[model samples]
Target: MHGVVLAVLLQATMAGGKHDYNAAFKSADESGKPLLILVGTNWCPGCVTMKRSVMPSLLRKGKLSEVAYAEVDADSQSGLAGKLMQGGSIPQLILYRKTSTGWRRKLLIGAQSEMTVTTLVDRAVEQQAALQAESAEQSVVTASHVEAAE
Candidate 1:
């Protein structure tokens, strides 16, 4: 089961252009992978650097294989972008992970380096795995207790 989940996450594709928040969210939910959003406008330099340099480099290195990614243009998708932004700069990389209790959000404001982004992704994956493992263990314990009662 763990292998299957990891495989699904690693196999998740990252979309470069023409992004839709709804679609990306749906895909992440269905695939059990975290949703990663890059919010920026074409005019923003930091945004450009993220879209052109950072993201592509990460994708090439297979660092972003475990998450569903989307690029949101703040100019065009202002409504969605405004909602997602936590009062920060142009280039904001937001990650939404579904945990055992609910959704967990992590945000990085401004242009970030490859190492920084990689660390963020790695931490998210690790946290998610830990939460899932704990959940599974609880389920097993609950099942055993119920069986003994029966």
Candidate 2:
């Protein structure tokens, strides 16, 4: 009975809170993927709306697999939220790209609908592809230059 109660409490606590951004970012780095940060407060209706309506639709339509999704609570992680977003508004969606500058923003601060979210995700994928192509081209150019020098 005691163990059962403890398990329930643990689940409740986790469900009631926001995601761990550091951990999520680490996972995305490991997977060589982008990261999506959804900043929201538990009591914020807009946040809840985005989570339930926009997020699920994107997920269902296979629009969210290329990146990792994480949620930060504005109320709980106010300092982190403030650093990321100027206004500290709920339902702030941020896309991050891993680079020499660390997690740089690809997009910031928008009112998200399902279509808008899908379009944003598609844009992120396109950006990633462009970066990869540029890197490959650079490598090819470097190899050719090295061969000419030899």
Q: lDDT of each structure? A: 0.85, 0.76
User: Candidate 1's residue-wise lDDT over 16-71, tens digit each?
Assistant: 23355777788888876788999998889999999999998998899988888888
What TM-score against the true fold does each predicted structure earn? 0.83, 0.79
Return the lDDT, model 1, position 58: 97
TM-score, cand. 2: 0.79
Q: Which regions of candidate 1 deviate over 4 angstroms?
A: 1-19
lDDT string for model 2 (36-145, tens) is: 88887767788888867778678787888898887777777789888777575567998887654566675556457887777777787777777778878999999999
Looking at candidate 2, the ten consecutive residues that score lowest on lDDT are 99-108
lDDT of 1: 0.85
